[model samples]
Target: MKRLLTILLLTLCVNLSAQTLRKYSNEFMNIGVDAAALGMSNAVTAFSSDVNSGYWNPAGLVNMEDKQLALMHASYFANIANYDYAAFAMPLDHDSAIGISLIRFAVDDILNTTELIDSEGNINYDRISKFSTADYGVTFSYSRRLPIDGFNYGVNAKVIRRVIGKFANSWGFGLDAGVQFESKNNWKFGLMARDITTTFNAWSIDKEEFAKVQDAVEGQNQELPETTELTIPKLQFGIAKKFIYRHDFSILTEVDLNIRFEQNNDLISTSVASINPAFGFEVGYIDMVYLRGGVGNFQNELQIDNSEKIGFQPSIGIGFKYNCIQVDYAFTDIGDQSVALYSNVFSLKIDFDCFR
Candidate 1:
C-alpha cells in the first residue's frame, strides 16, 4: 500500500510539471473575482467600476466615487476547493485612483498516505499526515484619467505564489495594462493586456520530502522536475452601450473578445491566434436593483460518436444596492461546457462614505 501511494504521488507530480509547461500556467489567477462580474460570464472589461475593477480592468478604477472594500467567496468540486478574494480601492485625486487586491484558491486537509507503512514492514496509521495545497496572487493597481476627455488608463503589478504541501513551492511576477474610453453617446470601449511581459514562476522542491517518492517506479522520477513555468500573454477587447428609459429604468449591453496567441479549441481558431466571444447584459431599476445574464466560453467539443459540436456556458445573477452597501449573487460554472455541477458565488461591497 505504501509503495502504491508513493507511485501515485510521483505520477501526480509529473502530471503537474507537464501542465505547467503548456503555457497556461497559474490558471487560478484567471478564475476571476467579484460575483457581479462572474455572473456576467466575465464580460465586464468595459463595464467594471469601483473596487472590483482592480481585478477586471483597472482603468475603470478612475470611476470610483469613494473609498471602498470588496470581498467574495466560492466553493468548487463539492466544496473540496475554496476560492476567496478581497480588494480595496480609493480615489487619489480628481483624475487618479489606486487599488490593491488578493486572491486565494486552496484545497485543505489532504491525507498523506505515502508513509502509512513503517520501514520495518509494519502497517502504522500514525505515520499518516495531512497537508494542503494553495495558490495566491496579489495585485497592485493604479489608474489615471488621460488629459483627453473620458479616457483612462491603468497598470497592474502582480506577485504569484504556489505551494504543494511540503513538497514544492514557487514564486512568480507579472504585469498587466488596460485602457477604457467613453463616448458622448454612452458608448464604452476597453482593452486589456495580461501578462504583457510573460509571467515566470521559479519552483523550488524540497529534496528530502520528494526523495521518498523519487524511486517509486523503476525507470521514472529519476530527476528533479522543471524549475520554471511560463505563462504567455493574452488580450481582451470589449465594447458596451448603456440606455436609460423614463429616468428610472436602464439597460446595458456589452460584448467582449478574448484572444489567445496559440491555436486551440476556441470558437474561432487560426494558426496565429484564437478568439472567444462573450455577450452580457444588465437591466436595472432605479439604480438599486439589477438583473444580469451572459453567455461565454464558446468551444468545440468532440462527441462520443467522433463528431464535433460547439458548446458554451450560460450564467445569471442579481444584485441589490442600498445606502452604502451592495450585495451580489451569481450561479455559474467553474468549468467549461463539460461541467455538470454549477458553483454559487456571493460578494459584498461597502463604501466608506457612510462611516465618514
Candidate 2:
C-alpha cells in the first residue's frame, strides 16, 4: 500500500505540474504576489523590504520599522484568470517583526458541457453547467535581525487549499525559510528555501459528482481517482548592488538563481540539472518614482523553422510613492500571445506610522 500510494502521489504531482506551467507541484506558491517583484522578473529576494516581503523573503520584513498593509491584484491571460494577495506587517520590537498574508488564484464561470443527443438527433444544450477552480493560501511569518548587524533571518508557515468546483479538493501545508545579509558598501545577498520540508497535499474526490457527468456523456471509460501530491523543495540565491549618485538618484541591479531538484527533461540537455537564472534592474528618483525591468526563465527551444532558439520572458513596471502610500504597476510577457499571454498587476501599500 505504501508503494502504491507513492506512485499515485508522484503521478498526481506530474499532472498538476504540467497543467500549472511549473516543474513541481503546488505551482501557485511560486507566483509572486508583489507587482514590484513581478515587474522586476522576480529578482527581489534581496531587495524586498516592504510588507510584501512576507511572500518574497520573510527576512526582509526585519527592515520594516512601521506597521504596513499591502494589497495586490492581477489579471492573467487577458482576464481568463485572476490572482489577488494581501499582507500586513507589524514590528514586535526594534529588531523583530511579524506578518500575515493571504494569496488566491481563481478561474471562474467555466461552462460544463455534455454530449447527450435529443430525439431529433441534435445535441441538447438545455442542461449546461458551470463551475470554478480556485487555489488559496494563508501564511504567518516572523523575522528577526541578528545581534550581528546587517544580518537577518525569518520563517513562514503556510496552509494551502485548492478546489475544482465541488468535484475535488485538497489541503496542504508547507514551510519556508530565508536569510538576508547586507554589506557596509550596500551590496546585499539573500537565500530562500521554499517548501523546505516538502509540501504535501492530500486530495479527496467526490466520485459521485464525476459519475453524474460521466453518466450524461454517451461513452465514458474513465473513473475518478483520489490521490495526493508532493511539492519538492527549491532554493533561490540572490545578489544585488546599488549605485547612488547625487543623493537623489539610485540604480539597483540584481540577479537570482533558482535551483530545482526535480528531474526536468526540458533542461536536461543543457546541463546535468535544472538551474534557472533571472536578472532585474530598478531606477529610483528621489524615492518617489521608479522604473523597473527584468528577464527570466531561460529555456532552449526548437523553432518551427527547425532552428534552435533560447527563450526568455521579460517584464516592465513603474511605481509611484507619495507620503505613506505607494502604487505600483507591472506588465509581464509570458511568451504566448494567442491565449492570455500577457499579465497585468497592480499593488498598493500604506504605512500607518508615516502619518504620525
**Separate clash counts for every candidate:** 0, 1
| Candidate closest to the true structure, highest lDDT | 1
What is the C-alpha lDDT profile of model 2 across 256-332, one tens digit per residue?
A: 98888755523333344577889999999999999999998776677799886777788999999998998999999
TM-score of each: 0.93, 0.87
Full-model lDDT, candidate 2? 0.81
- Give the range of the ten consecutive residues with the poorest summed lDDT in model 2: 1-10
Worst 10 residues of 1 by lDDT: 14-23
Q: Against the correct fold, how does model 1 do in TM-score?
A: 0.93
Off by over 4 Å in 1: 1-21, 215-222, 334-336
lDDT per residue for candidate 1 within 192-271, as digits (tens), equals 99999888788888887777655433455566676777788999999999899999999988999999999999999999
User: What local lDDT does model 2 show for residue 354?
Assistant: 78
